[model samples]
Target: MQQTKRIAIIAHNNKKNDVLEWAKFNRFFLAQHELYATGTTGKLLEQEIGIPVHKLQSGPLGGDQQIGAKISMQEIDILIFFWDPLEPQPHDPDVKALLRIAVVWNIPIACNRASADFLITSPLMRVEYQPYLPDYQEYLNHNYDQQTTKVRQEQPVSLDTA
Candidate 1:
């Protein structure tokens, strides 16, 4: 990863204001990086941070999966997701998947304001740091049941919500 990181930020409906406040407080460091966000959060961040943010769909509408895809593709270097743990989300699976993907890709993830603060202020953000990528070739090469493979091939997962 370069000094200018590709940062993906997300906030649950209940935590939107908290995240916005956090973003506003850390505007200086955040502006130096490439920012990405989901739906309303993106719009709010852009207004508050005064920087371009790559906006994806709303979380329940597939934004979480979009962020996961970006992480899998190495497009995102860090994730700042301010999710509400106390609340039950309609798209909880997608949130789990996004978090899983972030871990699978070995990127830094901050789930709360305190962690986000630590991440943004970390010295590593200002330098080029290459994370160790786990090789998944073997996993991909493993043979699956023909029936399952055929079923999966027949029904490809689409990320589009439209």
Candidate 2:
């Protein structure tokens, strides 16, 4: 079976044109995989490239958080985010969180056209490659244990003197 990658594409308002052009240039390559995008970007790509894109809500309207959730759940294999570094975003925290989750999950991510080109052209793009993912269950368990301990320590001791 051929391995198909689930790719998420996102672009800031200022970089949408750049992402559109890049997507057009790589349409053939991208068509082989599953595509997802934030609202406007998804509509633009679908209309211009004639490719199906799963559209999430607009970034400021929680689209970035949706993508972050997908990353955490391992539903996305790659992320192509053309964020505008020169401009401030109203949803900057969401963007950072999305990027952070991508890193934590050890997924491939491209922040620019150059990196996207490299990622799409790499031999591994056509083959199945396993990335090293840290075991987070241990961390979750540790946190839960610590919380339990803290709650136990904070419980009021019952004083019964009859």
Candidate 3:
């Protein structure tokens, strides 16, 4: 990862203000990085914090999936998502999938203000860091080998009678 990170900030309806407050407090640190957010959150961050953000569709409208795609593509380096656990979300599955993609891609994720603070303040944030990526090719080859063996075993021998 580069010293200047690509950070995605997202917040559920009830947690928007809390995320905004956290963003305002960390404006100095956040300003140096590339910022991205889902619709309303992005607009609010721009209006309240004065930091420019790349806005995507709202979470319910596919923003979480967009962020997940970015993470999978390695375009996003970190995620700060303040999701409301108390309130049920209509798009809960997207939220879970986003978190899963972040982990699968080995990106930094901050689920709340406290964790975001720690993540932003960590010395690692200021340096070029290479995260460990698991080798999926090996896994694919293993699975292919198993499938090929199974297919061969499943095939019945046909004797040709002249």
TM-score of each: 0.87, 0.95, 0.89
Candidate 3 deviates by what RMSD? 2.4
lDDT of each: 0.94, 0.94, 0.94
Candidate 1 lDDT, tens digit per residue, 1-162? 998999999999999999999998988888899999999999999998898999999989999999999999999999999999999999999999999999999999999999999998888989999999999877766645566778888996899999
- Model 2, 48-147: lDDT tens digits are 8999999999999999999999988888999999999999999999999999999999998999999999999999889887878779899999999999
Tens-digit lDDT track of model 3 for 1-162: 998999999999999999999999988988999999999999999999898999999999999999999998899999999999999999999999999999988898999988999999899999999998767798899999999999999999888776
After superposition, candidate 2 runs with Cα above 4 Å error:
none
Model 1, position 53, has a per-residue lDDT of 97
lDDT of 2: 0.94
TM-score computed on alpha carbons, candidate 1: 0.87
Point to the candidate with the largest lDDT.
3
Name the lDDT value of residue 119 in candidate 3. Answer: 92
Could you tell me how far off, in angstroms, the CA of residue 25 lies in candidate 1 after the best superposition?
0.6
Q: Which 10 consecutive residues of model 2 have the lowest summed lDDT?
A: 1-10
